[model samples]
Target: MSTAPSVTDRPRRGRRPAAQLVGIALAYFMVLLDTTVLAVAEPSIMISLHTGVAGVGWATTAYTTALASALVLGGGLADRLGAYPVFVVGVVGFGAASVACALSPALAYLLVFRALLGLFAAAIIPSSLALIAALYPDPGARGRAISAWAAISGAAMAAGPVVGGWLIAVDDWHAVFVINAPTALAVLVLCRTPITTTRRLRALSWLPHLGLAATLTTGTLAITRAGHRSWPEAVLFGLVALGLAYGTAAVDRTSSAPLVPASLRRDRAVWTAFAWGAAVNYALTTVLFSVPLLLHATATAAGATLLPMTLLVALNPPATGRLVAAHGPLRPIRMGFVAFPVGLALVAAGTAAHGRPLVLGLGLLLCGLGVSWTLPALVGFAVQHAAPDAAGSVGGILNATRQAGATVAAAVAGAVLTQDRGSGTAAVPFLIAAAVCALGLAGATTRHLSRTKEAPVADHVAEARHLGHMSRTSDGSSGELPGD
Candidate 1:
């Protein structure tokens, strides 16, 4: 087994450890919170703006598609320009967009502003991980830090409904967005710190990324429209989406500046991780988005109602981190997949049988367990293998895929949810989502998770190299960390 570095091998830092780490986590928390919070508010927004489910679906997809589109480019920009500038700009832009969303008078305006929110969020999500790598350069320190980071940020995915419920009860749909302004302000103030990371000009192919955005946007339009009895138009949009997706891939293959390097694209582990992350998000978002509409309860009531599930999601990551650390990610990851399918199935059964809250609550509890188990392990699995100076890009790729899953899941939920299906039950989407989560189980059982067996210490030196330290040598010299 590999051993921990000695005290002398550790960095001599001029750092505010708590402040810097907390600030970095806060940035991610803000970004993640937006994605889930909107779900609970969707029904209320549809009512307030006099819009249908399709309208709200468009708004939701606009935000996620833009985020998924821009994340790779955002990471590249962070590598080229510097993470600090990119992150700050994203935060400011996100704040402005959130306020704009609050002021939107119509669904059309809300959709545009939500897309703007996503564009800025792309900048925040990927770059934020690099900031964590910068703050905690030691391998063990970095891993633990990332665990906490994932815990906090992951909690947002489950906490959105809880938070949004209270906000909706107090005000209207506007409060759902308006609340972000102060949160964004807090992030800006808290995250102002100094660290340095290596910056090299990264060749970025803008066209492919733009094409990706277009593809998802069109696809979202198609899916959302299809369920609303607009098959002809949806078919037209679907054709355009396929064309755009193919074009983006073609360009990526040929472009000197591909969004993702061809090598990473070809790596089995990388693709597996990306796909699994997408599946995970799809299941979670599907549940979050659909449940509120199904419940027909007040926003606060719905949020409180989901606490059986969300509470576990909010609370379980620390233990998950420890479990993964001791047993490797495979066990927890498997546990998650098991819980996901069972939970989803129970929810489906409960809902189909006429809204049995007890069965539903058990299902929700398992859903939370699944998420809390799965996500941290996925993150640990990916970051443990990154190349030095590629932390932002690696983090970006993982998160972008996760967000992609989240976006499409929301669109799919909206697609199936356009009907006046009464309340407290929608068996079809939940069952489909369950099947998808089951696939995640089979998909993740590759050599990637099993690779820990090849090396007991599990890339300790590689991790240290990946997230470089700011430390004194024998002569008492030191340097700054990366991703400033």
Candidate 2:
């Protein structure tokens, strides 16, 4: 087990290591940009591939389903392997996959490569955060870095449409995939810093992992088919999906080595965070998927339309940093639960009211506020409370829920809006999103109220407390850096 350094031995910890932080942030930025940029590009993809909405929906489903399915396993890998090596492999593999995607000749080829992208992405996501945990061993430093890292997502969120539009204008749908290649290389170079090596003999259950992946993928396909109004196919796939989920759970129940650790399975905060994450991404993915399609927007026009919401995404983090410093993480999260539903409802109203720009813009603004307020804070909250060695595992689980939300929203939006591509159908998704957020709000509030102590308070105080608590871990390893 590691212990904190003495006052004399304490590392300066004055500032975040910029190169590593930027590399970590940029890796996630590329991932988010890929998602956001592709939202507008979906129309272009449909046109280029000579496919209808359902085909386009499958393309997205293939990637997100692969991601959600593989993340927990990825987390385990990050623990067994060192974070740095796992992260490097992910970056290299992601770049190669991006190149393969750019070269694909048909939708089938593209779908295969897209799944590869998600697979490599699974490696990157958990390990990158674990790298952050190692890089900033001080909870105080790590919290700020985590916030900054998450905030950078707003830049990607904001840029996705504009960048996608610009690239589409310059070439076509392939440019979006091609851009990732260079970005991946840059991440590799920037993230070359040597840090602590954390390894664990974490148990991995492949059968359960495969079962969960199948469950999500088949369920997604069910939603995709149901969106096209193929009730028979939907029912078949849905039943299969349910069967897979049940089987996976049963296997997990009896397994000597469960896919997820029992400690994580028993954590109330983790479960609540999972639900909350799902709610946030459901609203987000719905908007990203539907608006451009319903409005019949070109890339540039879609960028302008989404700007109001995306801009708010960028603006929220810095303020959230201060808000987190003062009022604590829960306030922003509560505020977000309120803002998300209202914004979604307004977006639904705007879509129903003849695609009114004013209403849509206002609604998007609220959605942005909701995202900015909640997501970074949530990241900080989860990471702050976790055991250092389990950082990757926690990151994986939290992101798995978030990605699961994205996958479900994409499927739901595809099913709902793809059916008609009409203003009426557009309103249905936002309405549904609002209801989901309301449930999240209720759950989160209930959790806060039931707890006796506001233990997950501001990072500075929490960090000090955590340092005192885990100065030496069970393994008796030092949670310290060379100097810092």
- Superposed by TM-score, candidate 1 places the C-alpha of residue 80 at a distance from the truth, in angstroms, of 1.6
What would the per-residue lDDT of candidate 1 be over residues 89-196, giving only the tens digit for each residue? 988898899999999989889999999988888787657766777667776787677666656665665677789888888888898888778877887777666555
What is the clash count of model 2? 11
- Displacement of residue 342 (Cα, Å) in model 2 is 1.6
Question: What does candidate 2's lDDT look like per residue over 366-406, in tens digits?
Answer: 99888777765665555555555555355456666777787
TM-score of each: 0.84, 0.84
Candidate 2 Cα outliers beyond 4 Å, as residue runs: 1-21, 133-154, 191-196, 255-257, 264-269, 377-392, 456-484
Error of 1 at 387 (Å): 8.5
lDDT for position 247 in model 2: 97
RMSD of each: 7.3, 6.3
lDDT of 2: 0.72
Ten residues in sequence with the least summed lDDT for candidate 1: 470-479
Candidate 1 overall lDDT versus native:
0.70
Residue 256, model 2: Cα distance from true site in angstroms? 5.2
